[model samples]
Structure formats: structure tokens, C-alpha cells
Target: MSKISNFFKGGSSSSKSKHHRSRGTPSPQEAIHKLRETEEMLTKKQDYLEKRIEQELATAKKHGTKNKRAALAALKRKKRLEQQLTQIDGTLSTIEFQREALENSHTNTEVMKNMGYAAKAMKQVHENMDIDKIEDMMQDITEQQDVAQEISEAISRPFGETYDEDELMAELEELEQEALDEGMMSMGGLPSVPSGNLPSLRPGQRATTRRKVEEDDDMRMLASWGT
Candidate 1:
């Protein structure tokens, strides 16, 4: 009975472990983060290996003529470090490729999700609309706009005298002719002033004398017209 109970307990534990594993699976972003971390670790390892390789090379050079065995040992160690560095390089490359691919896939998934939402929104917007109904509504709107414009124009129309263009032009010409005739008649009715009637004076008094003669001439002209 104890053996059977142990077997059942083991089975239940296995099932729980599987459930936990399923739940604990990392998302793509988390996986990418892990890959980046791994890449960074490998890069640091590569750098360390390269520095060691350089150190080995320097040691080999230093011991070249002095001790053949030491020089040979240094070269061997350098070779091993180089091989490890090469492996790290390959691993880093693979991790980087995987990270980039995952990032691209995640971006594509988000884009597709957003596009789906946009399509759904457009579908909803067009759900209650048809091409024929839309055209009819647009036509009704245009007609209403035209009606409104005509009503506005009617309301703003001049309520005062309305004259034909030709008649207004003829009347304007008659009024202009009357003004011109009045001006000419008034100018012609003024008596002519004798140029010799201006008093001879010095240069300094010339301006004052000219002004006085103009005033007198104007008075005489007006009196003669009145007579």
C-alpha cells in the first residue's frame, strides 16, 4: 500500500512539474532579453580569451631565444585560447541572429494586431452605410447648401432703387454734363482783368502788391457779374 501511494504521489508531482514548466515558459521578449544577456557574457568571454591569447603570444616572443620549451608551451596555450575565442564568436553570432529574428517576429505580430483593429474599426464605421445611400445623402446636402445660399442672397439683396445699367450710365453722363456746363458758365461770366492794371513795385513788395491786385480783381469781377 505504501508503494502504491508513493507511485501516485510521484505521478501527481510529475504533473505539477509539467504544469509549472508550461506556466514558466518565457515570452518572446523575455527570451530575447536572455539571448542578449548570453551574447554579452560570450562577448566578455571572447575579450578575455583574446587578451589571454595576446599575453601568451607576448610570453612566447619573450622566451623565444632564451627557453625553447617555455616558448613552445606559450604557443600551445595561445592556440587553445584562440580556438575558444573562435567558438565564442560563433555562439555570439547565433544568439544575435536569434534575438534579431525574434524581435522582427514580435514587431510583425504587433503590426498585424494593430492592422486587425483598424480593419475592424473601418468595418464598424461602414456597417450602417451603403454607396447608394451615401450618394443620396451627399446630393441632399448639396441641394440644402444651394438653397441656403439662395436664401442668404435674397435676404442680403438691396431693397432700395434698382436701376438698369444703361439707364444709370445715361443719368450719370447727364449729371456730369450739367456740372461741366455750370463750371464753364461761371468761368465765362467773370470779367477779364487787364494785365497792365498791376502796380509796379520793388522786388520785396512785389508779392504783397500782387496779392492786393488779385483781391481787387476778384471783387471787380464779381461786381461786374452781379451787374
Candidate 2:
């Protein structure tokens, strides 16, 4: 045992005795054997309990249970025990797995190395056995998993991809053309003039306001009258 401890801890020969000491935690091989034993024990207990329940039900039906409520209570108790037995069966299965690994490791040094890893895993399991911590971890994992799933789902969609430069430029041109067309239509095919209600001329053309044109007409009439 000291040798095994020293093997793992890199401890010195003098400290080997303390290092190799077992905490009575079952080795993988031992755990597997115990799992088998537990499996058989739970199976037997379950069968017995089932038989007892059946007997009680039959007797109650035949003799007419004085109190239906009492019979119901007994039924619930049996169900609770059955559930516990089911949990035990599951635990036994895990033990069996440990046992098989232990057996494999005994023949293969690699497997044995992994067995120490399994022991560490078991230690972590024990440490996190608290309901609240376990629940919190589970919730955190669930939330992260959900977020990842959502992102995956979104990215898989056709719309998830970004438009390339060429595509963006083409779209921009189309929008600009549409706006220009709308502006032309709104202007009744002519460009918008200033608020003075005068004809807006091109850069080389002369601009004439209605008031200025009317004043020119008045000056012409006065010249004709003088002539």
C-alpha cells in the first residue's frame, strides 16, 4: 500500500507507509464486486416488497379494508420504497462499471492509472453532493447549453450570413436610384424651384421673377405713352 502511495504521491520510501494507507474507499475492483452484491440485494428486497404489496392489496380487496385512507397510505409507502429501490439499482449499475474497469486495470497498467483518475472523479462527486451547489451548476450548464443551441440555430438560418461588399454596393445603388426616381416623380418631371414662384434657371441661363417681369412691362407701357 505504501508503495502504491509513493507511486502516486512521489513520496519517499520512509513516508511510503503513511502514503499507501487506504481510506477504506473501495477500489474500482472492490466497488464493482460490491455493486454486484448490492444489485442482488436490491433485487431480492424489491421482489419481497412487491410480493408484500400484492398480498396486502389482495387481502384488502377480499376482506374489505375498514379504512380506504389507510390502504391508500400503505400503497404510497410501498411506492416510496420502490422508488428508493430503483435508485439503488442505478447506483449498483455504476458500481458494476467501476468494478469492470478495476478488473481491466489490474491486468493493464494503463487501466490502473486510469483507476486513480476514477478515484479522483469519485472524490469530486462526493464534494459536490450538496443539492444547492449541484443545482446551481446544473442551471449554469443548462443556460450555457441553451445559449449555444440558440446561436447555432440562428447561424444555421439563411439570413445569418453577412452581405459581401459587392452585394452591399449593388443594394445601395438600387436604393439611391429608387430615391431619385421618387424625387423626380414628386417634382412632376421638373426640378423643384425656389419658394419665390419664379423659374429656376440653369447656371448659364437668366432667372426672372414674376414681379420683375411685371415691372419691366410697366416701364415699357410708360415708354410707349411718352412716344
Residue-by-residue lDDT tens digits, candidate 2, 1-227: 98897786765653666655744455656665676787688778778867866766665564446877767766666677667767767876776677677767766976777898999999998985888988999999999999999999988888655769998999999999999899899888875666787666764444455567889999999999999
lDDT per residue (tens digit) for residues 117-224 in model 1: 999999999998899999999999999999999999999998998879999899999999999889879898787677676666798798887899999999999999
By TM-score, how accurate is candidate 2?
A: 0.31
- Best candidate according to TM-score: 1
Candidate 1 to truth, TM: 0.61
lDDT of each: 0.93, 0.75
Residue 170 C-alpha lDDT in model 1: 97
**Model 1 Cα shift for residue 184 (angstroms):** 16
Q: In angstroms, how far off is 62's CA in candidate 2?
A: 3.9
Q: Using lDDT as the measure, which candidate wins? A: 1
Candidate 1: pairs in clash: none
